[model samples]
Target: MSKKPTLRDVSRVTGLSMWTVSRALGDLSGVSSDTRETVRQAAAELGYVPNRVAQELRKNTRRSVAVITASTSNYYYINMMKGIQRTLRPTGRTAVVADIAAEGVYTRELEDATVQDLIQSRAAGVIATLTLSLDSVELLEKWDIPVVFVDSDPPAEAAMVPAITMDNFAASVEVGAHLAGHGYRDWLFLAYPSRWSTRADRERGIRHASERFQANLEVIESENDVESAYATLSAHLDHGSLPRAIVAANNPMVHGALRVLHERSFAVPDQVALIGYDDFDWAPLLNPALTVLDQDSEDIGVQAAQILTRIIEDQIQSERNGRPPRPAYQPADRRRVEPRLIVRRSCGC
Candidate 1:
């Protein structure tokens, strides 16, 4: 039987020094990017795979999971990441933060490239706030890795991953009812691109309650950025079709909408009411204080990490018992974190 190739073999084949080869294969810095790619390609051709789990065990290093998000600027994503880290700390695991651009914000190349990088990394599992495409999820399954989604649902075919998500529909319903109770009729819903999974669920909730209260609702789509939200609503303000309330889908939109309203002389809860989805730290400090549905992002993060950790443990146990690995597909395990509505002066409560 032929012996497996070693780092020396990769070094000899690539004509790089052993130290350089080691760093490249281990995904450490100090090697030029081109050289690392060359070494990696050569190693793949040679069928030389590193024993990632054994190396981590030998070094007594905590196994790592990649925590992925679309935008770090979102308070929701940031809080979720913090929660994931807090949950992982005591379990001898750590998180590697990775960002991806999704939903046509960039070409598929950019999103696929980021997922490729995650797959190539030595992380044992993944926890993501960004939705993974079906192809990307399949790739992860082909690699026999577990993924747990936080605040985003898995693609329809990604039946194995459990999603720790908010009950956006119910929360939106609560927000709508609360606003209706305050006698708001015309409504402006501020949101990011509808491609975002959370938006659909939230809108469904709002729609249900809007019908019940006989409220008129209109939705305006903006990019997921402060400047975009401000500019989008600024244009809306110019049309003079003022809704009695502006409901932002998330905190960043809240900031942008609030700025536009304040500058345009729309008094909160008097001329126009305001509320948003996230209960960010500054929500209560605003002049009229923003009403919000607190999603408990940290807890969602913690739950996602915990689920991923269990998947990892289950895989390890299977290997120890000489059982075939867990099946790549099972019934979807869905976990929805309920959101809470907090009424503040912003909503005229």
Candidate 2:
């Protein structure tokens, strides 16, 4: 059996010194850009692959950042990717997405990573969107990689991982207040239970305002998809119990709840009002139009990327300054981007 060619083969084939080959392939500043391209082409021609681990040990630049998101089906996540791309494109950093799809009949979106997978990806840094198991977090910590959490809060111990998220609690509060302004006191918050910080924050915001409005607010836990929402609401409808107003956590739930109400011949904003979080483009097209919390999707991505980039730059600087690459600061500093309330007929506002 023939063994694979090495960087030495690339150097010989490209008529470059081993040191020049190494510097070119490593994308170091000392090598001319054209020389780097020529060496890369020669390596490809000779089927010579550089050893990433070997190069990492010798301090090479990382070409990619890892992004683990709960699902790609959600438009919010799709929009968030747009944000990430906007930030990463010009900087030459590309994202490798790990989207964990939900199994059937599940609502709370979560992701768990096997250590082998994490080790194999060799991601220089990680950006996670939803809830990752404590074990996964611990594993990443042990690997000593930078992490930036988005749309979810990091634990107290992970203070170095800066978080970018919508103001869930505040958004909920705004929704509840808006519903109250429309003269509805009985409200139901359709949600999914998750360890993810967004759930708890949203609950905090909604509950606080619900109390302030002196309204009877209840939580309706449902699976992440539309079918689960239909089932949950159907069960409630069977008992002839319905809140005067409903605030769904995301777009799918809003549509699902609306479907059930329509099936039962309930007049929207009259028999019941509807509001939701994470505004969708289709919201205004709904018969009565949905009132919602407008999350700044692109902005969220840009800010997160910028923060992570700054962190990485600082780490590189610290290395130059004789400091070891530190784990992102402890006790992640959370930045809560505000969600704008888009009032429409759904809330009778």
Mind giving the per-residue lDDT tens digits that candidate 1 earns over 1-349? 8999987699899998765676677665557799899999999999999778633442233288887776666788778778889988888888987767432253456668877776556457787676778888777665456778877788977665778788888888888988888888888898887656888988788888889999999888888778888999999879868899988998778878988988988888888999898788787888898888898898888877777777777766654564433523234447767788888898887
lDDT scores in order: 0.77, 0.74
The window of 10 residues in a row where model 1 has the poorest summed lDDT is 53-62
Compose the digit string of candidate 2's lDDT tens values, residues 1-349. 7889987688778888765786678765457788899999998888888876656643735456777765455567777778888898887888777766453232323344433365445565778776566567766665456677888877776555678777787778878878888889898888865644688888888899989999998887876667778888888778858789988887667867988999989998888988887766677898898888888777787877777776767766765664545555634456878789988898876
TM-score per candidate = 0.79, 0.75
Given candidate 2, what's the lDDT at residue 63? Answer: 50
Error of 2 at 162 (Å): 0.8
The TM-score that candidate 2 achieves is 0.75
